[model samples]
Target: MKPFWIYYQKEMLEASRTYKWIWVPAVFLLLGIMQPVSTYYLPEILTMSGEVPPEAAALFTIPSADSVMASTLSQFSTIGLLVLVLAGMNTVAGERATGTAELVLTRTVSTLPMMGAKWAAMMTLMLVSFALGLAGAAYYTHQLIGPLEWGAVASGGLLYAVWLAWIVTLVLPLGAVLRGPAAAFISLGTAAALSLLSGLLPSRFQWSPGRLSSMAAEWMLGAGAGAWAPVIAALLIMLLSIIAAAGLLRRSPLSPQS
Candidate 1:
């Protein structure tokens, strides 16, 4: 077997044993369902809460179907992103810490395959989790809101997935250099900074990968039909993260604890 695939299989087996495959997607599914259902029932919920004005229910307006779906992706942006980052934070760093890095490095001729495998496994989990969560959100959106344009939804989901992949990929290189929690913190911080800067200077940073989350929402509204700059930038960043991870692991294949 190819080294990369071999290591990828190991990662998969480990993921199964750890129940990550089950719980991660479960969280995403719950988040996906919560948005539409909550939106659908917001007025009722507020009324039940007994803190609003008597006239508030009349002022409540149900959002459009596409908007609700887009907001579901936004939910993924905050809590979903946090869960995924924490889950993948230890890809390399944990291996190094547990002394697995030394064993794997001793067997392999190069760290590139292991690094590639680690990245590929992460992409697998991210893709599957997001796909499940998006599916759940889409199903609820269609059932509650109305019919949706599958083409735009697919495009938007792809943009958002790539945006997610970019951040998750950071864990690989960061894990090679720092402890697991530190890697997660730095990666999340970088993502937040980019997103904040992009929001503050959109015209100047339209090509930023940070616009991807917004772009995903825009696609749901059929507003980003021709936008491609952010997608390209995200791809470039993903490539860079992969390359950086390989180099960093080559330099320090073992963790401080090991």
Candidate 2:
């Protein structure tokens, strides 16, 4: 347990030194705030660009508050997720590739605690970044657009965060076995494929974690998210990711790719 905290602190310090703690949240806040601002000024923006006629500009309608907030979340679903995944892609792979893992494994009593600490640090960063981004988005949406149901925003944010955590968790195991960029690409690719499949087969893939993104938008829009299956499925996947990574780290501390 003590080792876990020690390792966790090291991971966080590294992130801080790298300015991840600053820029990541800042990016999320920017993404969130931009949604409502851009939507609210769409006509002005179009007019300034001179790409649209006055008649066409007049036809543009500002989305409702809830719709804008939902769209803000959608921004996280794509670019936000990409940024996080790329940032986390080297968590484990870098250690192994640089021979840092060899030193840590020698000093630590075992791999489980070290790996658990790594996972916890990653989870903390993801949650904090997402929460900040969501808060920023929600605030701008309310001020620029309209009132939002606080309950819906909280619930929807949790649901969306879960989906994100699950995707980011892939970095641990994938980074353990693959090179850094390969892990990032494969993780994002897997997430995209799952999201696409869930969208195409909503009825058949009701329990898919990918559906959580859509369900989160529905929640933000004051819609019932139906079953808790997606949340449960996401949790299960996250647990599996930890187990898989821990097992892999235990078995192949020196040669992760093997």
Candidate 3:
């Protein structure tokens, strides 16, 4: 237990030194704030370009606050997700690439605690960044769009965070064997495929973690009923990812040089 906290602290310090703690949260906050700001200013923006007719501009209406907040989550779903995956892609892989893992593994009895610490540190960053982003989106939505239900926002944000967690967790095990970029690419590809499959076959993929983004939106809109399946599935997947990462690390603590 003490070792776990030590590893976790090390990971946090590493993140700070790498400037990840700053840029990742900044990106999320920017993405979140931009959604509502852009949506609110769309009519004027289009008019300034002279490409939109007055009648067309008049037809534009601000969406509901809930809808704007949901759109903010969608923003996180794309670029925000990409940023997070890229930031975490090298976590384990870099250590191995630099021979840091070899040193760490020699001092540890099992790789599980180290892996767990890495995952926890990643989650800490994710949660703090997401919360800031969500808060910014909610504030702008309230000021520019309409009032929002704080309860719904909190619940929906948790669901969305869970969705992001599983996808980000993929880099752990993947990085154990693959290069950093390869791990990130495959993690993103897997997320894309799952999202596409879930969209195409809603009934079949009801328990899919990919459905979490939409479920989050629905929950924010006050229509997310019976969404426990995907939430549970996502949590299970994260656990499995950690365990797999530990085993993979135990087997191959250092990455093969190119």
Candidate 4:
């Protein structure tokens, strides 16, 4: 437990040193604010561009607040997910690349504790960034759009966070076996494929983590059904990823090729 906290603190400090603590959350907040703000100003924007006729501009109406919030989640699903994966892609691989993992292991801290700490730190960043972004989106949506149900907002955010979690967790095991960039690419590719499959066959892929984004949107819209299956599957996948990362690190603490 002590070792885990120590490593967790080290990971947090590393994030701070790298300025990830600043940029990641700032990007998320920007992305979140952009959605509602853009949606609110679409008619004016179109008018300024002179692309749409005056008649067409008059036909435009702001979407419902719930829809705007859901759209904000969609924005997070793409760019936000990429940002998180890139931020965490090197969590393990970078350590190995710099010989830091080997040095840390020499201190008698086993692979599991170290891996657990890395996972926890990455999650902490993800949660904090997401929360900030969601809050920003909600606040803007309320002021520029309409009131929101705080209960649905919280529930929807949790579901979206889980969706983000499993994808980010992919970096752990993938990074243990691949270079940082390659690991990030593969993690994103996997997410894309799953999301594509889930969209193409909603009935067949009901339990897929890919459904999490849409599920979150539906939940926010008050049309959500219970989706325990995908939640459970996501939890299982995260657990397996941690275990696989630990095993891979134990075998090769210095580098993937090693």
Q: What is the C-alpha lDDT of each candidate?
A: 0.88, 0.86, 0.93, 0.93
Clashing pairs in 2: none
1 versus 3: better TM-score goes to? 3
Per-residue lDDT for 64 in model 2?
Answer: 92
Report the number of clashing residue pairs per model: 0, 0, 0, 0
Query: By TM-score, who's the top model here?
Result: 3
Per-residue accuracy of model 3 over 1-258 as CA lDDT, tens digit each: 988999999999999999999999999999999999999999999899998898999999889999999989999999999999999999988988888898889998899999999999999999999999999999999999899999999999999999999999999999999989999999999999999999999999989988998889999998977878988998998999999999998998987872
Residues 118-159 of candidate 1 have per-residue lDDT tens digits of 888988998999999999988988998788888888989998
Candidate 2 global CA lDDT score? 0.86
Local error of candidate 1 at residue 70 (angstroms): 1.0
Better of 2 and 4 by TM-score: 4
Model 3: runs farther than 4 Å from truth? none
Error of 3 at 106 (Å): 0.7
Q: Which stretches of candidate 1 lie over 4 Å from their true place?
A: none
Candidate 3 C-alpha error for residue 182, in Å? 0.7
In candidate 4, the residue pairs with backbone N, CA or C atoms under 3 Å apart (3 or more residues apart, or in different chains) clash, namely: none
Q: Write the per-residue lDDT of candidate 2 for residues 97-207, one digit (tens) a residue.
A: 887788778786677677778878888888888888888888888888789899999988988899899899988888778888999999989889999999998888989
- List model 4 lDDT by residue over 1-258, tens digit each: 999999899999999999999999998999999999999999999999997999999999999998999999999988999999999999998888878787778886478888899999999999999999999999999999999998899999999999999999999999998889999999999999999999999999989998998899999998889889999999999999999999998888877454
RMSD of 2: 1.6
> After aligning candidate 3 to the native by TM-score, how far in Å is the CA of 252 from where it should be?
0.9
